[model samples]
Target: MAYFLSSHITSTLWKLKPLALKTTCVGSVLAVNQRKYSSKDDAGSEYLHRSIVPTMHYQKSLPRLPVPKLEDTIRRYLAAQRPLLDDENYSNTVKLAHDFQNGIGKQLHEELVAQDKMNKHTSYISAPWFDMYLSARESVVLNFNPFMSFNPDPKPEYNDQLIRATNIVCSAVRFMKTLRAGLLEPEVFHLNPAKSNTDSFKKFIRWVPSSVSWFGAYMVNAYPLDMSQYFRLFNSTRIPKPKTDELCTHQKGNHLLVMKRGNMYVFDVVDRDGNLVKPTEILSHLKYILADPTPAPVCPVGVLTSENRDVWAGLREKLLEAGNREAVQIVDSALFCLCLDEEEMRDHIHISHNMLHGDGCNRWYDKSFSLILSKDGQAAINFEHSWGDGVAVLRFQNEVFKDTTERPLVGPTTPPAPIDSASAVQRLEFKLSPDLEHGIAKAKENFQAAVSKLTIHAMEFKRGGKEQLKKKKLSPDAIAQLAFQMGFLRQYGKTVATYESCSTAAFKHGRTETIRPATTYTQRCAQAFVQQLGQHSVEQLQGMLDACSKYHGQLTKEAAMGQGFDRHLFAMRYLSNSKGMEMPNLYQDPAYTAINHNILSTSTLTSPAVSLGGFAPVVPDGFGVGYGVHDDWIGCNVSSYPTRNVHEFLQCVQKSLEDIFTVIDGKPIKSS
Candidate 1:
């Protein structure tokens, strides 16, 4: 595979000799045509919202994601490979870049520009990028799906499962109302260094988007009974014939799916009058489900979701044939999923087991939001990342928790209605054949096997948080990213190509840009700590720290400007697929594969009030590291396959952060 750089590559090849304020890497210098940002005094705040927003109020004025000039993208692509490649390999990649820029790259850029013009009325990358995401060959299980868990609320009343589930569903409805009302402020991602450029930044900034697709659909994992074992069973008239087209769960609908103890229930969050139900009403409905004592025959249908995408798609079609079309409609129409688990889970490991693939019976993993409340009242959300990134979901979760914690929980003073009268909630029964029953049994075994291989470590670093970084005049995200880099270095004695998501959400419908975090400055900082140890001066370390932070900031701004190398690369590849063209040499180069094979996939979700969820490693050899930066403490969750020792790596991250404090404070060293 061809290696490509992301952004901010300078042409100058100056290496660090003695520590300096700014250290330039061996790459093309990033030309700064400093665009001034517009301050409120100059452009006025009203100019920010000048355009008429159509559906989503803040979306109308935002600019479309730009296609970078071929020369710049090619230059960046080459520069990114310099650090990872040997001299010979680097030279080969450079030549390949020349071949691409002059030959195939020119043609592809022209086609993309034409395509961009066609999508000028809409986002150029939106549809193409989404389709491409669906075409990936890798398993979506751990890599693509990300989850977050909220710690127990301060209120003791929430310990009652029914009360917690009700409040959570209501909180989600409140968020949904906010989304529909367009009252939630659109996120601002660009850090415009100058005030004059602010207006331009506002005009072109990427922002957290409001997408209809993310909210109302269930991600259906469909699997059929094993063909070899039940060839004769297919001839039975009782079985409904399966079709492949019905397998996908991406379509959106209007109902909610609630799963508990292998039983599935369908209910409407809205009344016939189109008004959302009250929290009291929702609580009453959940209590009804809790009162039902009959155990549901385990439907292993949910486990098929954890399988490969193509395989699940096939199985979903078959599962639908077993009298589940109506059930599917209810699932598709629902706002989201509510998982009512009777089991208690206090630690991250146990929470992960339930959230990731709970019993393979009570979860329908297809929905964008799957809210789970345990018997002990611990809550978490399992989000399918294909619809949006962590930031979008984090925003929703933050608001829900904020509303829950701030408001008083008051039950109705009047007597409640009997459970039998409420037709709002109904249990969904699936008529599964004996053959399908066998499939369910097999799926459960497979799901258990998958969960057994996963290793999770949930640790809280009480040492320091965002406030500590503020005191050091450092970006909290930057310091955490560096801590991850240092941890990786300590564990493997080398740095892997790292990915830290940078929001491009300043633009219309913007999601994220890959901010490659393993910079030359970070490399040197890690080297200084490992090789020099106590010998490195504070000035030298400070210089490195400043350089790393500045570079990261630059990357963020570039990503916001749609200059991210990854998306452009991804778009170009998708174009080739669209045109039925062969894969370019730039993509086929070894360097490309090396970088894309990410060994360290990390993201930071900060919500001062809640403990965010964690996810599976993106790759078999990698680890999924998510950290929450609060006022006084940092909550970290590290997960990997059974083969990798994430616990040790997390310990290293803690040590690295402490060591950083020691260096910044000029304190005496204590060897751990």
Candidate 2:
């Protein structure tokens, strides 16, 4: 249960002598050279040290419960809108549908193209949220591998197993399930009204999240445990029984598909000796994993850092040039962080992925930064958030990018940036907060009840409302695109807007709260998009649209979503889970190690430039990162269209708006 050493400054006593002994409250510590401390020059110092601290057994847990499963919450709140396989005229949404497929497909190719830059971070990129949620969920589900053996002994001083978190910004994660599965045929998550698989789709919705959670649990639960040995999973346990492993939709009559109803192209990667493998290899095996079902799920794990900013400069130069021969001019917008490594295994480090996550690490740091180099000599940034909220995340990313680049948008004169230190004043620490643990516990019960209700009807369940949404149709900008592309489209059109879907079912409140922001943003965007439809001259309209976006962003009807900020505070207190939620945000903390693994990037953004990370997606190429983003829905549907490609279409539509604007005297049109 231990994840950290006490916050009481262990430095005061250590200042008197250089002691090599390890101290741990919670978490792990690699090996220590006890012999070095046994024969210290000053016996008096050793005795003093022993008197102040006693060697002890670990008997506590990390603070803070993991992010909760929102699937049941999603289903219950979304009851009004049907999520069926045939919910939409998939036969009709060709442009958007094909684009969605193409967007992911292109990313597949890019995943290969930029394979070197990717590592463990790729899979994290695949399902950032889901993956994090899974790590935490599985930690408990499988008892957190308490029996699993690690090589390093009692180096809790190196790694107290605490989890540090960073915010995820622009990403291509929604289709990761399908992408990982690497389906040969097109598989849609939204209902397909053209097909009668409504029952199947509904069943999928009901089953997928749980299955995903279990798969992670299976990984943890089923793994081999040799207390004196190392980590190995699946080899100890087989897949569950027919009922246990039965998936909702595989189209193939057999229920053997592991990632049923979703794409399962990516495979799990491991070392030849059957250990968790590196991210670089996982990415290499992606092609084969997509083709073969026998392989395990792949994870790409590697870390990058600003510590070796020089090395990154070289690699970035090479990567930027890796593209077509056209000089690959890139408008780069990068977000970075200063990872403070307090303790762990490698250089005293831990966690997953590239600088995107895993890069913020253990041993590779000086108070200012870490330059942990991989075999390839790339330094990984330590301390990037793997656990901060979107806004908090972006705020930090913006700071990192701004500081690293020497140019900040809030203007250099903005208040000195605050660090997300363990000592950071709690963002929401209010003195008079009431005890809502009971309500939160009740919410969890209700959420579980909702999930069970649907799971019971697993084979026959059907989500609702697709037909109506389909009838209303979606606007061009509703589609997602690489943000920069959306920016470019604005040069041609008078208005350029992005769409962000609110979590339609996060809190107990149904879609109403979710609906409010979507409506406000949608209306404002409509006004802007219509006015610019095919416009040529934009100096004036552009100014107005910018003004309107700023105005619209002020709408806070969707503010209630923040109610569950401390999702497991009550659960932890009641169950006596005893993990401190405010443990330092670091990579070596095992706390950071267990995170949502199958998360596909989705977010709630009101502003186009408002990156989930704040600084916006860096346009490596002239277009956005993945599909030409017309808009970004990630996976939320407060807007009818939700793919990056839809935004691509909107960007093009912006051009048409420019042309139309010339003819319409710069006035946006009213809807017919």
Candidate 3:
């Protein structure tokens, strides 16, 4: 069965998913191993005393969402998100999702689809964190639209071997469709809702059963939405009849399809609409996405313009020249673009239907791309990140240069530079909180309670869980179980809290966030991912279960509700993890959008860098997401670690469903 998270958890996970890596990277490379300290009475006082000091990296870019309208849009948008799972929309869903894999993914997949395809340099690295935003209201649409209602979540794709199958692949696909519908364009890029009884699209995608021991699964999907309905949603998100002429209104801004950043997209409704009052800016957004921009600055494939080449080669040597002293902090990197945009000739790429976002997506976008064009002297550029990694950026720049007189995208063409705010500039007094102190104390109490006197005696220092998993062909669900129990066994404290939070700065536009009762939410995920191990070895399962049960039970209830461990109350914590505080805040004092425990670019990975190519989104938990180097393998791959702790709350999730086969077949080979 596919276990959906609790309401609070679902929302929290969704929001946290986006900022997972970025937020955690704050205030100097956030140390993953940093110990949680309990706060004294001073925690709240410190927060209260900390006034709104401003910063520059991101100004009060957060304007109030037209309150009354925002509320209405949120309600309507959420209601439209649900799809009937029993119908054939299922096949259509797969067909749509598959487009991502086949079209955009094909570029990366063809190269890294098989292990042998990877050359020596096929390693994945963590790039720095950046904040991109969107503001919505409904004069752009009328009622609330689902995509803009809640903040999108961070999604991670692991290259680990598939172990268990808690939810059927169909469920996973459906969940993906649901997430896609909730985040981006639904109808075109997604499965057509149950319509005719004979849509063959439903028969295309198949679900994997819980049999495999080691499997590899990767999905990069983009769903579509009805253009008119979407436009209605868009209009609602904007301020109606501005008392004064405000907003980045286009005087010279002729409507052209444009994607702001490399990954997120934009479509001009005027161009496609044929007639328009105010040109609509379609932010073809991605929640957990992978894209490739085929037309501008990076497409027409392979060839790079002189200026673009200079930019790439120039950065390679860290040119001492004045004008370009490293826009992105990383000392080593490359940029290229994928030829995925087909908006001009056809609305969609050949892969699947989920190729565009928002309105005008299915009708025209499915056949053509949201092409960037110019009427005035200025030209517009657009593309998807699914083509390749950050390197693809330079490739796109080169394409844009081809049209410019410079022939090389030098002067005005340089896109925004990358920034790593591990060190936000707010000079402030730092103090610990009572909750922090209590959390630390509770963790210890639970640990002590969970580890029965016999655990120490019976536990072997290292019987080799990794080795065992390999041979047993453990599933992802199985790994979650092992991690839950094993992590506890190896942990210094009893209660292992899943660190979950988001970068408040990332989505200044939307006020809704998902994580509530952080403690219970995590505990349940721990149980769900862990307890399912019951299907495996009863002895190991019971032993681990008893320990967690006892730890949670004795750790609270009878224990005086004092000195930390409490079964009832839990608190939400926040930390100013943004480093952009050095600059001045225009509205408030040098204020900054504080990023709390976000996943900044890290120097780590959950597993050893494999040769398989393709991008992986930021995952929920396993390896702690924080700022570090790409070369550093901290929490590199989820498949490498056991997932027990997370599974406890999530209901045992296996690594790769394919891995389950080895276990059931009786001759399980070691994972290593």
Candidate 3 to truth, TM = 0.22
lDDT of 3 by residue, 312-412 (tens): 23322332232223321111111111112233222111111111122121111110112222111111212221111111111112212221221111222
Q: Per-residue alpha-carbon lDDT of model 2 for 1-672, expressed as tens digits?
A: 100110000011112121111111111111110111122223221011111111110001101111223332222222211211123422323233234234432333233324424432221122333223223311111111101111111222211111111111001011111112321111111112323123333234323342132222122221100010000000111111111111011121100101111122112222233233332232223222223333221210011112222332333334334441221110010011112222232421121122222212122111111222222212232221112112212222222322222221121122323332222211111111122223223323433332222100001001212232123232112222222222333443312222222221111111111111122333334444554444523554445434333332322211222212112211222122223333221222222122111011122222212111111111111111111111221221110112233244434434434433332244544433
What are the C-alpha RMSDs, in order, of all predicted structures? 11.2, 27.8, 26.7
TM-score per model over all chains: 0.80, 0.23, 0.22
Off by more than 4 A, model 1: 1-55, 137-139, 181-254, 408-415, 419-424, 668-672
Evaluated at residue 74, the lDDT of candidate 3 is: 23
Q: Which candidate number maximizes lDDT?
A: 1
lDDT of 2: 0.21
RMSD versus native structure for model 3: 26.7
Per-residue lDDT of 177 in model 2 = 17
Highest TM-score against the true fold, candidate: 1
